[model samples]
Target: MTAAFAATPAFAKDVIVQMKNQGAASAMVFEPSFVQAMPGDTVKFVPTDKSHSAQTIPSMLPAGVAPVIGKMNQEMSIKVDKPGLYGVACKPHTSMGMVALIQVGKGPSANLATARAVKLPPLAAKRMNPMLAKAR
Candidate 1:
């Protein structure tokens, strides 16, 4: 193992998901709503505006995994340790569809059905369906 032939992905990744808010709260969104990473990667949720926080949809997480919930305007980071589809949403603006998805590795998701069955706001549903499709 020489420096010239190093395996870059062997290292952990730190990614940022920005919560963007337009003039009004109803226009809030997550910039770059879809993210992909490998195990050990950490996704950082940053509030780019006001009144927004990142939290995982429990049913969307892999078995034995816990959900992540962040405070408004405060950043949150979650280490990726499994292969599955993870959903994130801004609780306050859920109706505006402030949602995102994280795809970890290339394995088939183990909780897609439960994730889909989880209750979602109308706008969140509109925003998350396509993302769930591509993730699976």
Candidate 2:
């Protein structure tokens, strides 16, 4: 006699990123600004303070992925299905260097260079440079 067992499917995880008024490194920042996630994982942007929103940088998106913009003080979740780097910014505070990086899957992607080449405001660039360097 043969016995049969039910198979359980793997579940996707939700990664939480907090938008804070003050972080350990700076003010008006995304705490844990750099995240590494697998494809299919969901990133939840939680606004811990008022006037903070999470929006995607167009030049940093993977091919076929649409840009996302969250309303200020609202919680937004994004499912990362593509394998590449994604750059996020706080619309109200981007000029103050409020930015983040999310690298999905392994290895560098084709658009990494393109993302790097996109010009950003001086302060935003300063904050993003280190996060970009950590990708891959």
Candidate 3:
């Protein structure tokens, strides 16, 4: 008698994004604002500064994905199992342009346009524009 076995799946990894009060080019920012991740990878938002937190931009979440909100001074990790672009912001610093863009999987994202169209405060928009451009 013989038996057959299934191969194990690839392991998911974690991507660390730091929330800082001061970054190389700006104040109140997420280091490496643009991230490329694989499905099932975890995006961990580490608050290097206690004043910062990470949360999802409602209009920028992929279909079937729930919003992620973190408490100030705490860290948050979001497991991205779907393929698309995810927009994250710091509730208190969003207006000051503290945001991050996580692109999961390869190829184009179906929600790119929708994510770009979401209205943001002037500073947030200014900071996100470049990140969004690279998402395509």
Candidate 4:
């Protein structure tokens, strides 16, 4: 009987994504590289600092495309209706490791872990090194 009830999506994973500011000059990404959500599953992005946002976009999105940036609301939730790889990033600090790869459903339509290894633009690289050095 318990097993029958468990078949519902009530047990689907709920993730809390956090954005934290470490200092006046630096911030950090506390999001996971891979998150799995079923169709109807929800994910929350919480801002732990004054100026941070979690935005979702298509995988391999072009540079100028606008992302779905989450605001500093009291609470926020995102429902997954499609099975695909979603790219997440912080608007102002994405190059500083403020990026996440969300996999909806049982598998990712595209793998973004390797994309993380792609070389950053020269400016993005310059902005990221200082924060990374501090983290180390």
User: Once all C-alphas are superposed, what RMSD does model 3 give against the true structure?
Assistant: 3.1
lDDT of model number 3: 0.91
Q: For candidate 4, lDDT tens digit of each residue in 1-136? A: 8997766666666787766666333456644434666766777877777667777744333233344657653334666656655566666776666655555666434333433444554544454344222221
lDDT of 1 by residue, 56-104 (tens): 9887888888999999889988888887878898888888899888988
- In candidate 1, position 49 carries an lDDT of 81
Candidate 2 TM-score to native: 0.91
**TM-score (C-alpha) between model 4 and the true structure:** 0.59
Model 2, 89-111: lDDT tens per residue?
99999999999989988867767
Question: TM-scores across all candidates?
Answer: 0.85, 0.91, 0.92, 0.59
User: Which 10-residue window of candidate 2 scores lowest in summed lDDT?
Assistant: 1-10
Cα lDDT computed for each candidate against the true fold:
0.83, 0.88, 0.91, 0.56
lDDT of 3 by residue, 1-136 (tens): 1232223226779999999999999899999899999888999999888799999998997898999999999999999988999999999999999999999989589899999899999999999999999996
Prediction RMSDs, each to the true structure: 3.9, 3.9, 3.1, 7.2
Clashing pairs for model 1 are none
Best by lDDT: 3
The residue ranges of model 3 lying beyond 4 angstroms of the native Cα positions read 1-9
Kindly indicate the candidate among 2 and 3 with the higher lDDT: 3
Residue 124 in candidate 1, Cα distance off native in Å = 0.3
Per-residue lDDT for 66 in model 1?
92
TM-score of 3: 0.92
Off by over 4 Å in 2: 1-11
